[model samples]
Target: MVDGTKKQSLTDNTIGALLMLNASKHGSEIALREKERGIWKETTWAEYAEEVVACAAGLEKIGVKPGKAVLILGDNRARLYGGMLAISMLGAFAMPAYPGATLDELKHFLGEVEIVAAIAEDQEQVDKILELKEAGAKGIDHIIYDEARGLGFYEIDGLMSWDHLIEVGTHDLNEAPGRRDEILHRSKPEDPAIFLHSSGTTGKPKGIVLSQKNVFAAAKNGHDAGAYGEAEEILAYLPMAWVGDYAITVAAALLYRFTVNVPERQETVVRDMREIAPTFYLAAPRSWDQMLTTIQVGMEDSTRLKKWLYHFFMDRAIASETRKLNGKSGGALEPLGRLLGELLVFGPIKDQFGMSRLKNAFTGGEAIGEDTFVFYRALGIKLRQFYGQTEISAISAMQSPNEVRLHTVGKPAPGVEVKIDDSGEILLRSDSVFAGYYNKPEASAEALEDGWLRTGDAGYLEENGQLVVLGRVSEVMYTAGGERYVPNYIENRLKFSPYIKDAAVVGAGLDELTAMVCVDFEAVGHWAEVNGVPYVSYSDLSQRDEVAALLHEAFQRVNKAVTEPLRLQRFVSLPKEFDPDDGEITRTRKLRRKVVQERYADVIAALYDGSKEVHVSAQVTYETGEVGKVERSLPIREV
Candidate 1:
């Protein structure tokens, strides 16, 4: 074993080098797995190293050079992961963009980075890049596609199949076998490793360049804090472009030798998760919320006896967790209740959600409902919240077992320093902090002051060192009467209700706050069926008087839990859900507040004008690229 000093010393090696080390240390160990055709395929560390080397040789032949950008567009699959490693092995940075990015967003990202080559998962992704090129997108010289099922006839220049690339590398290896070694040996920890774009909630997504050192540091900190070992298993089911995925799947897994599993497809994650039963999992609050929703809906449809037992035990678990939240040890029945709950209800539920083997589960990206947090912890799932941004390499603060608290984002991570600015903004400096934004020097300069990153999120540090993030500083609004409020805090409270899926609160300059809610379609639809409420589409269901009443009751519960000044007076179910495609929410599912406010300006006007209903012509975009308008009159209710 290494000494403490040696243990703390950061490695100067790049990820390619780390992969080589793992291959040398555990050549036979399974490093990766992917589900295809209902079969789970494994990749050993030795195979992983070989693939990276071959892909790197192939990429080198295609003009990928040191300091160049290689764009990777795909899901969490073996080829995509290997491509990322290959790009790094060549001393080139990998820029992973969302596979679901719109053509316009793709254009913007492609324009920002001088991408020399691109690796796409399938024809769908390749088509996006090809379309961009057809529109005169620049800098992209080569396109490498993995799944070539439907691209037999496409005559796109600079395009090559993945297997063909490997074959090309195999042929080139005979001529120049030392090329891969030379490239990897020259790569250093401080060299640029990946380019991750920000969520672009406030504006266009900015490229955040992270060095090998930044990713290594981030992974090391997480591993140290969580005591993650080689045995740790994780499902890389989230978007590959997300920084969180990069931190967990790419950085930490490579450094710590954890086995990372990829699902067959996005739709199959829930089912596939059970088979993997990942030891450590992380997802945004939205995903956790959806999981919770699934559980709640399942419970609703369960047999009477099962429902009764579930509620009984669940209440006890909630009580036990509540006591813990208040800093109490336990009540008289806490232990008995927890025991019975785990045996009767929580155990099977955890198994179903694929948390049976989960040592720790994290939810972040936004504030989760306190009820949701309590539910998971009460069920014996070790759910924790973490707070970070892309600029910080997707991690800065995370909750430990002892420091876990409801609604709090916990303390600074290991080797990370955090301070609350005089303006109530959080500032952080860490080994994992990214170097700067790519191509946007002015924005980067504004984001970093001295060495501290101005997190822009308004929050405070508790005496116990926990960080309480309260929405964005700019989003902290004041009423016309001068009472300040954070809309996100209130929105979280509203979202605690099972009927509410999402909500946007508006008050800012008004005397009383009003909200627009997106009803949980599955839950409310079931409720509608049970109550004999006739509704057709989402708009139709939202307009029903019974649905309005249900939402009003939910609003009342939220209002009762808050102060008088912060209570919402009027609320209306949105005629439609805030969709990413509609520009109402970001790709990260964060509400584009300015976009929402402007898009529903008429509804906001009606809410304040004492109108009983508001007529809206919602612009609906179909998957086929057809735009249609749906006109509806939504009722406005006073709580």
Candidate 2:
């Protein structure tokens, strides 16, 4: 129990220390599990404690010390978790970089952190690190290779073999049992335990330094709010690089003694999730989008009779949810609709989506269109939206049972005080608030003022006490007519169109809105075949006169949803999806508007002024750096 009277430090009940506590309390509990060689590889709490001690010793022998940082690059695995625990046990914080980061982003990020040591999962990651080091990185001394698979590229001085280092730690721990005690004693609650880099979608990344106190306590609070328990088995399927995943892996699982399940691989997540049937689930909006995609795509391939039946019941279920949305109970038709939907359609859908017995599921990271929320809710899945950021340990507000609402991010989470500033920015003061951004006092001070973290996100709390996050404060643009509108607001509305994969709304200074849309080629291809619309290549399909008219209709629907100035005035369907690799989207699939606008400035300019058809020759770089020109006539549409 933490006392409110005492100021806590990072090492206090830290990743290592918390594991030790759980191990001492329930030594035999399954702490971690992952698939290895077609079999379940699990580590019990007691065993994890022993390994953390060994791993910490190994890191110490290789020069990891308090206040130092160790970069971890890999997928979710038992050894990866152990490596992080080891880093934390050594009183050093762990920084998990997304393995998917671009070479330039990785170089700048790792260099910015000045990471002293790193644990790479495989040779590919090690090669990337070596490349960055060659390109000018400082203070990196150790590179612990987990896979040890083809390590020809690593320097001899920097290399640390995984098993050999583990043996060294084990040998030393056996020689001196008190060494574990000494290492544990060195940890304080305020010590920097982990560095979660900001998304950097908008600007340069800032490392969010989380103390052990902030994480563990926030997890404990979540337990009360969501009712997580020791018996609960959770799938750690999200990226470990994000604080959301780490909160579950380290904070909730370690501190509260919950079982953390790691999927065999990204591809097998659906199968693995069904096998695990996690009691509590957390996902970004895209995960649910993918889940919906899986069902929709699978249904698309099903027999017409089965697809018809599925839609028959699904439509009824949606109507029931719609009634509930209108403050009406699942009355007369609601129960009948639910009963029939569950019996025929939703049961199988939920079973496949692995939502059965899913006590609570969270979807955040962006505004989920209201329809998606209703679909999950009608299926007996309590899908919710939580509001927070990296600086607040990723949870400041969350929707609670039965109190949940559509199109809102819910009320302030327990023990947190939320206020809407006069500027309409969400203000927060909470125990879970992060200490600050690492070594960036000016930015940190700007973020935190008068005991409140000024969440630059704009939103308002409603009469019902639920929150409605509009969009980023910086993202909202005002028209020459003085009408303010958020592009994300328009984009969210656009994504609800099943054929539209993603959209980036443009037009800040001109008369009205415009957008660059990426059609769901796969979905549209199916639509075209079914509707007798002739199409071939993605570029060919996107440029079709019929396709342009369909997109125009979609744009008009969204345009009508907003005011005249806020309505989309013109648009151009992008021949390709917004991709992170190409810098049009962030790693998490959020549109990088600035990047997109800059890259497609000519096209955007042509959309409003010139004719609906324009020829473009784009210089594109391939993955291997081969450059080529892709020439095409991009089709534009006007409202």
Candidate 3:
């Protein structure tokens, strides 16, 4: 285990104070940019700080005080970011909720803290807050909304517009010149700056409180380790509720003085990203997989000559990358061939994905598929994996440029110490580690022992100091034959095939393994069209005889790589995709194993009872907040 004592001095600066410092030192530098109506708008550091001061003063006028919590519901926007810093300026915790959270989920978060005010991004967010208030949620006395287009007609008692709030704040600030500096200095390093929650993959989400010190320490460590550099360009598109987004876009951006760019809308993220061509980027594995699928599908429709060139070049490039990853040198002509391929094929692909300027890109939150990892590297993108949790300010270990590996999550991050316990759980100690879970002494005690945070994940340190994560310790399972395995490992391999989007491996004490798969509707649908197959809907297309044959071939290929006892014996393609609103997956796309097993108990029993088909009538939630039932008879296939 590495010692945590070899560390730099911890700074006493809060996030609000950092903003003030940046404004004074780099007043003319662009701190933020956002697209609106096909135009890019910029905010300088000075303006950003000024806006935060106004927002804090306005919030104080609406009963905001130190120790009170403020709800921030929205997509990534300059005003939303300013409002978050403004809350910190007042020494209040900024509680950001996922924009797509269901009303019930929002209610749970609201019940956890004493929220005095809220900042809503648009009319949709405002409506959810109004519904909660109508249902008798207390402590929320003011609602400040950014967009006023669809909300001008609302005649609510505590509702206000973003512009009006700023106007009031400016007036209040001008009344007392000394108040600006006083508000900027209100927060200290020990004060809680933000409130986050666990992903809830195992159960209900737990509230986590992080102080300014924790956020800054984590950001500083990443900067010191060369994760990001000063004035780097970054695209802020991930859900703000996730720790990854907050750590990089807000904390790190402020600390390193990077430019944070926000997309115009969710649908225009790709176009905006291409326009920005950010220097650094990070995304979950699912997103990387989707991009890969897009490229593959696009190539399928290209000219015959283009398709041939793609295969010829991609094959050689992947081979060369494989050798390098294994610490081997390539042929003398390999560099020339790579240059030619880049000009003809790979270069265009990178430009299309807006990764041409991505000097550093990362994938985390779960294990990435091997093919996906190698494909990007072969295309000349520096895609690496990192392992982290929300409790450790979102990161603890990450792959350096020189030590990239397929199975390990690189070495411990700067100033962070890692060790394994007797039970094989990974333990981490860092200045960035959170104090405890909010209002849950028992859970906090179980998570934090001494100064080390119990990650609850099973992993080990390599001889060279790299960390290899197997899976969640609690998720390890044994078969009736006494063979041990982690379902996620096999599941990730299954999803390596573009045809399969999600999979669940089940066989805790059974004779053999089985899987329930969700086919990628777009990828499979395109394949069906090209192969002259007919389908009416996702449900009908998934169970087609020809599609079953295709999946069987893919499954056979995966089975060839595993031990005979661990090979999947039976599989079923579900009629629908896993939806977060349905409680099948978390917002970050992690599977809810307990929920899935409980809901599919009947199907699991049928798989072991020699049944050829299982009838399913499941309730699904729609994006419109409506619940409906889907009934289908899924045919079980043998590998």
Candidate 4:
């Protein structure tokens, strides 16, 4: 096992100390870039350090103390990042809540912990927090806002602007120069740096507390594994509340002195990513699937000549790649074919997705489809899979370039020890393991044993020492015929088709397996138009016989890979997508099995009772926060 405790100059220091060191060594280097009004704005390391110091000073003046929790709510913004660091500098815990969480969810999170102060992005977040406070939420003494638009007229207690906070801090620092040193020295390596929440797929989310040493250890492991290099550029577009974002963008960036680029808005991420062309990137499996669908749809709309060229070259390249992955040699003409394909098709596709400069790309949070994995590798992108959890600082294992495999998540990362229990649960031990669950000693005890953190995932090691992660142990289901299977494995395979978006497989204690599928409206709509099949709305198009036939062919392909008993016997194309606001999925896009099963009880019954169709009246939350219901008669198709 790799020793994580091997002394490095910055490994023992807190995040605040590392920021100071970067400022001292590379003061003039660009540390961050943000898009504003369609122009890129840069911030130097010295300026970044200065702002953090000012923000910390201001927070101190506003009664923020050691061991307190400060809430950060927003998208990826430079000022929000600065606020996180400032909170760390003052020896307080930086608690980042999901920006899209409803007010009731926000209230629940607040009730779980005591929040002393909050730094919000704009009027929307400010309004939510104020509403909660007005509803009797306690311990929130201060609320600071970044954007001033639409918030100027309201006069409320303990609400101030970010600029005003910085001004107050700047004056305080000028008055007492030694106060800066005092503030910096207050935090130790073992002090809690961040407070994060679990995904809550099973129940109420647990609060996880991670120390500075934990964050440093995790970042060191990734650095030693060659995940990134010094001076590399990365796009910070993931949710700020996610542990992966904090591990890479905050911890790893400070450790390696990398440059982070922030997009202007959530909708413009693809456009901004292409403009940035970052060297290192990470995205969830769903995001990758969507990008692949975009490429496929674009090709479908291309001219005849271009479409033929794309298919000919792409098919040949994918075949060659498959042979290489299977440990077989490609023919002599493979090199020439690859060169031509790169020049004719792959090069332009990479440019469109801003992957030309990406040297290291990773996908985590869920299992990615094999087709999706092979497609990117054939297109000349170094996309790999990683296995991790919030308790382990976001990553425990990641596939290296030379060790790429379709099933494994790669060998254990540096400093992580992995072993399987007798019952087949994966257990991990490392310095990066979190301290404990905040305010829940019982849950903490259940999660940790001795020094090893019980991951609650079932998996085994390959002969080559690579880790093969199955779905959660609790999610492993058995059919009435005594066949055991994991639903996610089947769901991922069905989702490989560009026309299919999300899926849920259910067969526990039943005679045969079945599925609830959500179709990709844009992809299927394009296919319909090209084939002379007319449609009007998503619901109308989903119930069409043509759509059912298309999905049947896709299911038959997936069924060929599994045993007869495990194959999907039936499936239904739902009229709408699973939404987070409706509580069907988490913010990270993980399915809440209990919630989904309960909400679709009638549909599941129909799938097994020999019914040709099921009527669904699903509740949907719109972008404007309006609640409504969609009624449709969805057809169930046999494989």
List, residue by residue over 269-361, the lDDT tens digit for candidate 4: 999999999999999887898898889889988999999999999998888788878989899988898899999999999999899899999
Q: 1-639 in candidate 3: lDDT tens per residue? A: 011442434345677778887898888999999998899999999999998899999999998887788999999887888888889878888999999888788878877878998999999999889888888878778999988889878998889998999999999999999999999888888888789999999888999988888988888778776688888999999999999999999988887888999999988998899899999999988789889988988998999999999999999999988898899999999989999999999999989888889988999987787788999999999898888899999878899986899989988889799999999999999989999999999999999999999998998999999999988898899999998888988887788787888888999998899999989998899889989999999889999989988788778877997899999999988889888999999987888988898988888888899999999977788777889988899988898
Quantify all predictions' global Cα lDDT against the true fold: 0.84, 0.78, 0.88, 0.88
Q: How would you encode candidate 2's per-residue C-alpha lDDT over 251-323 as one tens digit per residue?
A: 7777667788888778788888887788889887656765776687788899999899988888777787788
Clashing pairs in 1: none
Residue 580, model 3: lDDT of 90
C-alpha lDDT (0 to 100) for residue 456 of candidate 3: 88
**Against the correct fold, how does model 1 do in TM-score?**
0.95
Candidate 4 wrong stretches, greater than 4 Å: 1-10, 303-305
Please give the lDDT score for candidate 4: 0.88
Provide the global lDDT of candidate 2 against the true structure. 0.78
Sort all candidates by lDDT, best to worst.
3, 4, 1, 2
> For residues 1-639, could you state the per-residue lDDT of candidate 1 as single tens digits?
012333435545577677777787779999999999899999999998888888888888888887688988888788998899788777777988887778788788777867888899998888888888888888788999988899889887899999989988877876887876765566778877788888777788888888888888887777777735555799988888888888889888887788989999998999999999999989877677788878987898899999999898898788878778888888676678777778889999989878899887898887777788888888898789888888888888889876688868988888789998888999999878886888788988999999999988999989988889988887889999999888988887787776787899999888999999998887789889878999989888987888888888888888887888988999888777877777888888777889888988999999999899898887777776577887888888888
Stretches of model 1 off by over 4 angstroms after superposition: 1-8, 331-337
Which whole-number lDDT from 0 to 100 does residue 156 have in model 2? 68
What's each prediction's TM-score?
A: 0.95, 0.93, 0.96, 0.96
